[model samples]
Target: MTDKTTSPPPSEEPAGELLLTSPPTFLGSVEGATVEAIAALAREGSVPTILQVPTKGLGPDLPDNVPILWDRHAQKPISLLEEVRAAKPPLERVGTAVVTTLASFIELTNRHKDDGSAIFAKTAWPEPKLTAVIDYHMPGETKTARRGKHRIAYPFPLTDEFKVWVAGHGKTFKQADFAEFMEEHAAELAAPDQYEINTFEPMFKERFGTPAEILDLSRHLEVNVGAKMKSAVRNASGERQMVFETEHTGANGQPIDIPGIFIVSVAPFLAGDAEPEVVRIPARLRYRAAGGEVVWFYQLYRWEFFLRERVQDDLARAAKETSLPAFEGAPEMAA
Candidate 1:
């Protein structure tokens, strides 16, 4: 009997109205330019949103208004050993040891050049001065113990050869003084094997003032030995559930599934040693269609490193090599 004004039921509300009433809109994008646009919108007091961009080149220019949502991706290519080996230059069947030794020397010298300060900081060793001396003995025999002793007796006088050595170590030493100092040390510097003597020249100059500084420097300038990190991956759990099994189409318009495994191993720095520790670290991977022309949506995956104790066993062998007095100052933890 009441005048019932017919009203629409709550369920009859429009979807857009329901959406608007439910919550303020939050949007997300991964493209850099798109993120810039969303940030502009946010600055105007619009609804807050999130955008995720590839970690590749996102610089400091990111806006303060927008929040970043990082989604981890599982690292692909489960095995890194083959991949790393394949990446290296082909080794000759003969003279493998010599080649490896030279390669190690070159690598060490280049590393010293690039981050000499960092290396010195870690070791508390003085900066090495590169010098070159004429080698009276032939190349192959120069490394032998007897030859090494003989060379030490007539130590090559430091000369322009030192400058050349520094330059060969890295191109960054253009301004470094090579000849002036050699003339100063000409009286005291004794010849050692060309290779070994040259390697230690920089250390000698750094620790000692002149020829008199060699023995003291030799005591402290131990070769810093450590493993190089090859690759790494972390465990997959918790938040990692997000990147689980999103499909990815391949280059030839085919679908390829990628699994997550972050593997990392140390590169051997010393000779006659087994591999160093293989530790897994956290990592993310991205996948996209491989076609040259058409673009596709990229998929992200997250995974964690699965550490194996066996890797440590392999690293133990290298650890043993460093036990001798010769390697006392090598950058390594006590066994």
Candidate 2:
């Protein structure tokens, strides 16, 4: 005869070992039937573990020792019971706060105001300044308080916008990548000419930043100039502009105006003066014929001078934009 014994159901068994401590801990669920070794790790008192949930189910049995933080969208519809906490009590706090988003920050500000006042009140707080980590690191309240009553400081992480732009000052890009670099800093190319920057360049696939007819004509000339380019730009439509003909018309009873070899405009990624003071750069277009192919390239006259002028103009503009005191020297890390 076999020994008759009753055992509990599988569901009734504890999912895992739960440590009832200051912050209740759950060291992951148990594995399948295998004798495994456990290594020693810091206990609840030394290093308490935090649990994050996507749902707002603070359901039936919650341990008082554990606190769960779930980022609930502040504007989402909530239950009547959720409203109870708003009027519960008047608590005071003077602790430092760093909100994750501007919306959340605004929500918090609105929540703390008097009964019927709007979240975006006229007396609402000003935007807190984003100070560098070094400032927060130094000793004192002036740095902590920052510029306003509400403040948020960030650790100078590499991905921060300011950090990224500052880092770009030291970066180098390949010729192939130069176009992308120009695109990214396109705004820097627009300080002149009110707000519109008109340019005619032959490299791009389509007409841009210039009058329809002008750009179309420029691209037409560019693609038709060489046999290789003609092959590259030709389409199935077989539409070609027969601009040049095999004939002799030195002057058709009138003086022909020859387009200047130089292209006069602001250099890319450079600050240029408002015209008619804009610099005129001569771009000598010369084609290289080798290996039965033609490659086109241009040499800009006075390019170095243009760069030097732009840098000086940029520095001068920087000085004019702000009233802050500045000195000419390399920037140093604030100790």
Candidate 3:
């Protein structure tokens, strides 16, 4: 297999046979050096300057000048991927790769009355002024075949307008704000006094199918419940716990034996800057041991049951306000 060069050697096939075949492909590395060489040739008008992404996809840090054809199977907003795949034949005919991030681009290009003033938020990256082109291989396309490498032919013109959008928009690309958000959440988790578990009493009753009680201890880290399941609760390690009784001195000075059956677990929450008020909480129920220690617990599986109602309502509100951009070639995609 030959690596596509500026001047590919003439094949031994007859001229008429060559006409019947597809254009030859250049297959090799799409690293920074390889892309730069292709760009140089494209600028000189020596060869077509279209790039097709491999099955593995390109690295996140490719230069802006290298417009890429993103594979539909790679990452997601499924609807957008469908739209891109549907538009492939037309896009191939025009010789330009469709480049945009997320499903927001679809909404942006095809604006509707339902989409009001919502702004789609994305972590913008700072790179050269070029729209990141992405595409996948269409059936019957030609490419070079090498060990651990394959090529796809893209014979399209990279227009100036597309370049400008990629360069300008890429600057807004920032990293996801999960780190800071998790830090704040962790701080709240470390200090029990920062939040009142009592406030969640009604929530626990609604979620666990019975009222929950707070166990009297030096530190109120756990909630105790009395719901008896057909099966026993087991912890993550699959350990079973024995039910226990502990002596509790009542207000009247009488010794009371408290029965501890099950232990309640705290749920994990995740928040972002955009929806700081919303949290995803999971619920876990566990069994108590003879030593007044929680040994076995059920998994925290249901997300909706533990999530605060107000947070869920707020997220729904934010969904309505989300908006997308009107890409330069979006209209052509529909055509």
- Predicted structure with the largest TM-score when compared to the true one: 2
- Model 1 alpha-carbon drift over 4 Å, by segment: 1-256, 260-270, 273-283, 289-335
Each candidate's TM vs. the true structure?
A: 0.16, 0.26, 0.23
Estimate the lDDT of model 3.
0.30
Q: For this target, which candidate reaches the highest lDDT against the unseen true structure?
A: 2
lDDT of 3 by residue, 30-138 (tens): 5778899888876665433345434434567665454444333343222356777887874222232332222332333233212221212211212111121122222
Query: What is the TM-score (0 to 1) of candidate 2?
Result: 0.26
Against the unseen true structure, what C-alpha lDDT does each candidate score?
0.26, 0.32, 0.30
Which structure is stronger by TM-score: 1 or 3?
A: 3
* lDDT by residue (tens digit), candidate 2, 160-229: 3223333344244322232333334333332223221244234322222222222222333322222322
Task: For model 2, give the RMSD to the true fold.
Answer: 26.4
Against the true structure, what is every candidate's RMSD?
Answer: 39.7, 26.4, 30.7
Instruction: Determine the C-alpha RMSD for candidate 3 after optimal superposition of all C-alphas.
Output: 30.7
- Candidate 1 local lDDT, 1-335, one digit each (tens): 78878887677665665343464545853677888987887665433334543554456875545434322232222334677898999652221112122224233323322111111011111221111111122335545421111100111122343333222321211101212332343442442344533443453332112233332221211111122111111122111111112233332333433322111122212322423222222222122222211111111111111222322332232223322111112222111
